[model samples]
Target: MDILLSICAFILAILGIAGCIVPVLPGTLLSYGGLLCSYFASYSQMSTSALWIWLAVCIAVSLADYFLPAWMTRRFGGSRAGSIGATIGIFVGFFAGPVGIILGPFVGAVIGELVNDRSDFAKALVVGFGSFLSFFVGTGIKLIVAVGILVHVVADIWVHVVADIWPAFWNWLTNLF
Candidate 1:
């Protein structure tokens, strides 16, 4: 049971890391899930306080991810069209790979702004840039939280599993020599 939980935790941690840039996945929440799995494992040394703290951070980051893009768009004078376009771009970009993912929101925002107000190319560009910046900021924060959770899970595994087994494995190796 412990091993199974540990494996699940590792898989979740990896997925959480990928989710940070993928946009469709809830990276921080997935990471928090991983931490929870690890916490439940008998070998885990994680404290209840740490789990609660991580849960708070995950929720906060998730909320920020949802709102940051819209806030940035509005801050840069973008409208609902721009935000909608950015969202569409994210889904569309998913098929185009990394470069597309990176540029999709900006292009979408620009196109949306242009569609909304063709007379103001400069404003559209500003809105597009704002959306682009928001992507980076949001992704950066999510990545940080996800990575932190991964680190914690890994440390727990190392301390409990690897460290415990290392001495025995070393002895076996020495006897075989």
Candidate 2:
């Protein structure tokens, strides 16, 4: 029973982590759910309160993940055209899949800036690069929080498995490395 439950928890955590890069997945939130699972899976020294706080952090990261790029870009003097371009890029990237999603915003921002700024390459590049940097920052935040939540899950699960005198199995295996 414990093995099955732990497996389920691991799957959720993996999905959550994937969500961070793919943008199509609810990575941070799913990570929180996995942590919740491990925390409640069995009798152990799980810190429920700590996991709760961590979940809040994950939620904040996820929310910021979507908004931070535009917010930072706007703050850095990105034009309205740049902002619209980033939005369109995000959705269009969804259609092109992962690689598309990754590069879509930068391309979109450049094009939008060019159209709005009347062929000014330097200005468009500025907005495009600023948006790209902000996006990386956002991605870093989500990855950090998601990993933290998953770590908590592992720690919580470790306690139960150890107490049960079962060997701790790294379910992530070759996938993690």
Candidate 3:
């Protein structure tokens, strides 16, 4: 049961990291789930304080991922249309691979701004840049959190499982020789 939980935790942590870039999954939340799994595992040495702290960080990062781009678009003088377009572009861009993921927000914001008001291409570009910048910031934060959780899980597993097994395995190997 402990091994199963640890495996689940590891898988969730990995998915969380991927989710940070994919935009479709809840990256930090998934990481939090991983942390929870570890906490419940008998072999985990994760403290309660650590769990609470990670929970808060996960929620904050998740919320930020949703709102940051729109907030940035507005900050850069973009309208609601630009924000909406950027959100839509994320889903559409997912099908186009990495390049699309990187450019989707900017292009979407620009297109939306142009559609909303064709009089200012320059403004549209600025708004697009803002969305692009937000994507990087949000992804960075999510990645950091996800990776941190993954590391924590891995460390716990190593300490509780591998460290215990290594000595016995070494002895067995020596005996065989």
Candidate 4:
């Protein structure tokens, strides 16, 4: 039962990493869930207080993930339409590869600006650049947070699991010899 729970936690952690890149998944939150699973599976390893702290961190990161892109777009002089387009592009680009993912927001922003104001190519380009920068920035933040959670998971496993087993295994081997 412990092993199964551990496996489930590991899978969720992996999915969290993937979520960081995918945009559709709640990367940090899923990673947080993995942490929760690990705690429940091995209650001796981590305290409830520790789990609560991690939960707060995860929630903060998730909330930031939602706002950062839009905030950045506005900071870069992108209009509301540009922000909306970038959002739509993100979902659409998910179907495409990495290249599409990067370009989708940019193209969408430009087109959105163009549609909103047909006479201003320069403005459209500027808005598109802002939208593109926002996407990358958001992606970077999510990646960092997700990776941090995964690292925590690994460290917990090492401390609570391997540390417990290594000595026992060594003792068994010595006795056998």
Candidate 5:
């Protein structure tokens, strides 16, 4: 049962990592959940403060990741159409694969602009550009935070595991020097 729980935790961690890049998933939160679960499995062995800190960080990072992109797009002159297109592109790109990821936002913008007015390509492009720029920036920020959060989770787990098994030692079998 313990091993099963640990395996479940690892699976959640993997999902969290994927969530970081895919946009549809809350990578930070999911990753943090993994850490929490691991601690839960070994509750008697880990400190409570560490878990609490991680939980707080996870919540904060996820909140930032969620809000920053929308704020950035609005600040950069993106219109409702541009925002919608960018969101659509994000989902559409998921189906289209890597190349589609790059083009999805642009395609969404063009279509959005065309829908509003055929001759307003220039305006739409501008809005689309803002959306693209904001989204790109937002995703980058999100990725960084996600990586940071995951790293912290991993490190915390390592320290916890090591502490739990303190005094256990193995003779070095390899001489790298």
Candidate 6:
């Protein structure tokens, strides 16, 4: 049962990493969930304070994820419409794969800008560039945080298993390879 929980948690961690790029999944949160699972499996071994800290970070990052793109849009002189369009584009881009994910926000921003002001193509382009940059930046941030959480979880699990069950750890490692 313990091994099964660990396996499921590891899978969730991998999914969280994938989610960072994919956008449809709550990458950081899901990754954190994996840690939570691992914690449950070894409740007495895991540090409660450490878990709380991770949860706090995850929540903060998730909240920031929502605002960064829009904030970035406005920072680059994009109108509210452009921000909204970029948000929508993120959802649409999910269906189209990586290239589409990169382009969707940019194109959407441009279109939104154009719709807002037909006379300023140059400004629209600028806003589109801002939106594009923001998307990539946001994705990078999510990837970093999710991976960090996954690493922490893995390390925590490693400490528990290696310290408490060294023989089992060595046996498992040998078998895994």
Q: What is the TM-score (0 to 1) of candidate 5? A: 0.67
Tell me which of candidates 1 and 3 scores higher on lDDT.
3
Candidate 5 global lDDT:
0.63
Query: Per-residue lDDT of 16-104 in model 1, one digit per residue for the tens?
Result: 99999987788888888889999998877889999999999999998888788767888899999988887777678778899888988
Local distance difference test, per candidate? 0.86, 0.76, 0.87, 0.76, 0.63, 0.82
lDDT of 5 by residue, 12-105 (tens): 7878877877767887677777776667775435577867776787777677655553454455555666566666776787789766765677
Weakest lDDT window of 10 consecutive positions for candidate 5: 165-174
Give residue 87's error in model 6 in angstroms: 1.0
Name the best candidate (by TM-score).
3
Residue 153, model 2: lDDT of: 73
The RMSD of every model to the true structure, in order and in angstroms, is: 3.1, 4.9, 3.1, 4.1, 5.3, 3.0
Q: What is the lDDT of residue 98 in candidate 5?
A: 68
Which window of 10 residues has the lowest lDDT sum in candidate 3? 160-169
Every model's TM-score? 0.86, 0.84, 0.87, 0.81, 0.67, 0.86
Model 3 segments beyond 4 Å from truth? Answer: 165-177
In what order do the candidates fall by TM-score, top score first?
Answer: 3, 6, 1, 2, 4, 5
lDDT of 6 by residue, 1-177 (tens): 676667667888889998887777889888988888888885336688988998898888888887876777788999999898777777787788888888888888888888899899999899989989988888888888888878877876776556655677688899999
Task: Provide the clash count, candidate 6.
Answer: 0
Candidate 3 per-residue lDDT over residues 49-127, each given as its tens digit:
9999999899899888888888898899999999988887777777888989888888888998999999999999999
Give Cα distance to truth, residue 7, candidate 6, Å: 1.0
Predicted candidate 2 versus true structure: per-residue lDDT over 81-103, tens digit per residue: 88878767777877897777777
